[model samples]
Target chain A: MAFVEARDLTKHFVIRRGWFARPTVVRALTGVNLEIERRETLGVVGESGCGKSTLGRCLIRLIEPTSGQVLFDGEDVLALHGEELRSLRRRMQIVFQNPFSSLNPRMTVRDIVAEPLKAHTNMRGSELTARVIELLRQVGLNESHLYRYPREFSGGQAQRIAVARALALNPDFIVLDEPTSALDVSVQATVVNLLEELQAELGLTYLFISHDLSVVQHISNRIAVMYLGEIVEMGNAEEIFHSPMHPYTQALLSATPMVDPETRRERIILEGSVPNPANPPSGCHFHTRCPAAMAFCADEKPPLREINGRLVACHLHE
Target chain B: MTEPLLRIEDLYVRFRTDEGTIRAVNGVNLEIMPGEMFGLVGESGCGKSVTGLSILKLVPHPGRITRGKIWFRGENLLEKPESAMREIRGRHIAMIFQDPMSSLNPVFTVGHQITRVIRRHHHVSRREAWERAAGTLDDLGIPDPERVMRSYPYELSGGMQQRVMIAIALSCGAELLIADEPTTALDVTIQAQILELLNALRIRRGVSILMITHDLGVVAETCDRVAVLYAGRVVESGPTDAVLQAPAHPYTQGLLNALPRPSARRKSLQAIPGSVPGGIEEIPGCPFHPRCALADDLCRSKTPIMTPVDSSGAHLAACHLIGKSEG
Candidate 1:
């Protein structure tokens, strides 16, 4: 069994339009099935509104999935409750997307990192302070930052603080949701390296969710491509990035601008924006914008089938 | 070589904060040739955007272009009066910001906003302005420009909104377009489309572009010439291909090597050792020495001036170790 596995996970956000209006369902995740090995990073890549974030939340049980099974070490995450649930949360934590909003502006850095330790453990006073300071140093911050608020720190430093807070409990698994996307390139480089170091030292597993393919490629062992809440392709990071099977993945990789200026890549610019999740296409969700979509693609939803040691959902493959 | 279209000489911008004076742009120098796309790229607080803003005298108050010579079209713009600056701003030079939604007016119709920009610069009637605005939209590859013109900013998608912003920027028949991270908020596909549009505009209309971005990939793909900024100074300036192929400055090399390349797999990124120093505190040596691995005693004492790295003399890098490292 994988260290973490999600089976047919789906999340539908139903918003009520006025008191009398019928509720509309925004299908954020339509049946995501993926797995992460022990001590490995799984990258989920997709454009906006693709439910990659929802999948990240589901794996760590940050939010309840509409219908799915998230197995952590072959144990069902959805079944735990009370003390067991509280304890289980310590093993899995999440880092959010935006640094400015994730950390509380009112609280000092010490209090913020110590919050998780206080809630989950009996550590108090000097002991808690020592642990918080240690955590801060682990993330490349020092003693001076302990009394400072989130606003006082730069974007990269704030994100490091957030990472420190996530690592306070020494969680085995963490869902990093666009942790470095909000930062600049050079600072992002620092954060990326920090994550790698922490992962190595702590033997941590990560569900690294990001829209930036390049950043994801650097950290991920295996990569999964999502489109409109469905897992379009999943394979080795190098394989998926170098030669993607799914058309959506291909388009994404093509659009990813490489730093080398000499080679002018032949990019297939997709025609339109992502389809409205609430009113998705009839069959295959990607058929609306897929280039190699067959005539029957509009009517038949493709199943994720195994091919060449990788799983891909497309009509051409199966 | 052809005469440069826009030349920014020894620009310096500073902010008066309560803590102290923040040196934003410190002795920066760059030249943009006519009909060429030049990229000014760096991380936050690196003064890439401030340099772009200084070109248009758009640096916000509290933040002032303290010293600079902005030469555009064979004239020094720094010496020009505010009235002359205003006359040059929208008519000859226009700008597009990062976010499309915030940049575009929310209450106004897209057509009305675009036509207003046209009317602001050109002596055209409302009908003529509207026609020209729609025509500009059409040129931007928007289908049914009339229908789009009638819609409000909120009605359009983000990609469409960006196209509208581009429409307005180019509406006044501007020759130079200053795009400050124009596609940062956009999706990759939308960004590719917008980049293509910008490239198309450049090819067709011969518009000079001053594109500022943090992503080196964007610069690699679109820019003809590139300037690498660090700590409010130009560390390197060269042809895009030459600079990207072999970045001389340790900072530029670190940035390129650290940037996650899709083609390469790495055990760990070569992160720069230290963070950018807070504000320009009059560092005696190279501003990047604290973070640079190859900094020597000379590099720590005296600032390195831009020296030609190639026979062309166009590829320049400000690094004392460039010779030592290359050896």
Candidate 2:
């Protein structure tokens, strides 16, 4: 079994209009199937409102899924109740996207980092202080930052504090939701390096979620491209980024400006904004904006299938 | 060479905070020829935005230019009175902010917002301003300009709002546009459209653009020349192609390597190790020495001045490790 498995996971939010009227459903995750191997980073790349964040929330049971299975160690996450789910949560943690907003402004850095340990363990006094300090140092901050509040630190420092807090439980798997996007580019490198080092030393697994392709490409071992609650493509990062099969994937790659000027890439500008996720198209979710979209794309949904050793969901490839 | 449209020399901008003075833009120098795109690339707090803001005298209170001369069209802009700057701001220079939602006035209709700029600059009547605003909106590829004009900013999408922002900026036929991470909050497709629109406008109107961004890729695609800033200093400056092809400064080199290229695969990106120092009194030697791989004793003790690299005479970088002129 994979380290993490989410099969046909679905989450829907209902928009209530009136007491007697029927509520409208927003299908955040229609049917997401994914597997992350042990000690590997799985990147979930998508634009806004694509349910990748919802999927991240569902995996850790932070937000309850409407249907399907989220298997960690062959046990259904949704089914785990009471103390069972609490213990299961120790192995899975989440690092949110906005570091400034995620950290508690009222609490000191030491208190914030030790909150997880205090809740999960009986460690107290100097032992707790030492552990919190160690966690802070692990993420590249010093002991001097222990008493500082979230507002005292910069964006990069706040993120380090969040990372320290997330690592306090010694979790095996972490859901990193755009962890570095809120930071500056120079500081982003520092965080990226810290994550890589920690992953190597601790043998950690991560489901990295982001919209920035560069950061996603740098950290992820394998990548899954999502659009409107559907996985358009998933493969090894090298395969998906370089030889992207799906048109959506191609357009995304071409749209990004490269750092190198030697790369004379003709940009593949998509026609319009992402369609409203609440009222998604009938067939392929990406057909409306896809450059090579076929007539059948509007009528039939493409199935995720293997082609050239990569998972792709496009009629042109299949 | 043709006379440059805008030239800045020894630009020293400072902001007074609770923690003493912050050196925002220190001795910065740049020139943009007419119809050319210039990029000021740097991480946050590197004064890229401040440099852009200084061009239009839009730097907020307590953040004042201590020393510098901003020459636009053979006239020193810093010497101009508030009245003169008012005429120069919308008539000659306009700016597009990072967030479209906050930048656009909430109460006004999109049409009225754009017409306000057109009327202010061109002295057109209200009806004429509205017509011109509608035409400019249509020019910006906004569908149903008439309908969009009546809609509030809250009613429009982020992309549509950004397009509206661009139309307002371009409504007055401004000669220069300072885009400060205009598409940072947007998605890749929307960002691409905005870039393409700006590129098209430059060609059609012969407007010089000063694009400020942290993304090196954005600099490469749209900018003719790029100035890489570090600790309020221009650590590297050159043609975009030259700078990207062979980055001389250790910071610039690290930034390029840190990026994940579509064609390259690595087990781990070689990340630059240390965070940028915040609000230091003064930087000794090189500001990047603490994070630089090639830093030596000399780099830690003395700052290096920008010198031309032999590959191209225009390519300049401030680095002790790299020689003054290397073939």
Residue pairs with backbone atoms closer than 3 Å in model 2 (clashes): none
Best by DockQ: 1
How much is the lDDT of residue A53 in candidate 2?
95
Measured against the native two-chain assembly using Cα atoms, what DockQ does each of the candidate structures obtain, in the order listed?
0.71, 0.60
lDDT of candidate 2 over B84-191, digit per residue (tens): 999988778999988999999999999889888887878779999999999988888878999999999999888889899888888898999999998899988788
Candidate 1 lDDT tens digits, A74-102: 88999989998888899998988887899
lDDT of 1 by residue, B199-265 (tens): 9999999999999999898999999999999989999999998999988888999999888876567
After superposing candidate 2, which stretches have Cα over 4 Å from the reference?
Answer: A17-22, A261-264, B262-266, B289-303, B320-327
RMSD to the true structure for each prediction, in A, is 1.6, 2.1
